[model samples]
Target: MRPALFASLLLILVSAPMTADCPCIPLTHVWVVKTCNDWNCASTELAVANGDPQVIAVPVGMNDSRWLVVRRFTAGAAVDVNDDSFQLKQFDGMDGAVKHYSGMTRDYHPMLMTAPDGQVLVLSTKQPEPRGRAVAH
Candidate 1:
């Protein structure tokens, strides 16, 4: 075999995307919280890796609350959220769609901003879509 041929083959193999045979795709964990009040009481945390997602939602009061949703996927997996993958969608408290935003992660942490009202949706596989929200492709 020629050295050039070997090098070309190696490059192709390296550039190829990782397959299921290799390992599970990376899992991203995002945490978003905001208070019903206007005070500085909002906080968010995000992390990404090869793991599972954990979503939790808790009601704060009779008319105010917060939701925590986890969206997971393979390292290179893409879900169709508002015609986009690896993105987040915000619904108007089970009503209309507010907006669509992409995930921004740096150093295994996502740089996502939290919202005050409505529900949050993250695109991932092996999970059911949120109620009253569009499903990812």
Candidate 2:
């Protein structure tokens, strides 16, 4: 019944991270989204919502290229991400991971990293760690 206790509970609930990437996120609808090549791309505020991650349009020849991949995670598949989830989750960037073609399976794409939480992290050809080419120091 205390006001302070109620306030503290509210703060904790507000700060919690939502499981948006689960059940494998989706692509934003056509026309409203942007890609890595656009010079006047929309800012974070005007960008797609968490429920709309579908790649509406990609850069020229970007789809088949091994350099970039935009996608959502699958249910129960943890993204297998870490504190660096920022770079991996960015909507556009060149520092992405390098998907190892040799490591890919017949059923799945080369970049899909399925974690236990149903998070499928679609890394690029420049991702760090097992995906990156550089030896970690």
Stretches off by above 4 angstroms in model 1 are 18-137
Clashes (backbone N, CA, C under 3 Å), per candidate, total 6, 29
Would you list the clashing residue pairs of candidate 1?
Answer: 25-74, 25-75, 26-75, 27-49, 80-136, 80-137
lDDT tens digits by residue: candidate 1, 19-109: 4266655564333332223112222322222233332333232223433343333334553343322234444343233222233223222
Instruction: Give me the displacement of residue 93 in model 2, in angstroms.
Output: 24
**Candidate 2 similarity to native, TM-score:** 0.19
lDDT of 2 at 125: 30
lDDT of each: 0.36, 0.37
Write down the TM-score for model 1. 0.20
TM-score of each: 0.20, 0.19
Error of 1 at 108 (Å): 42
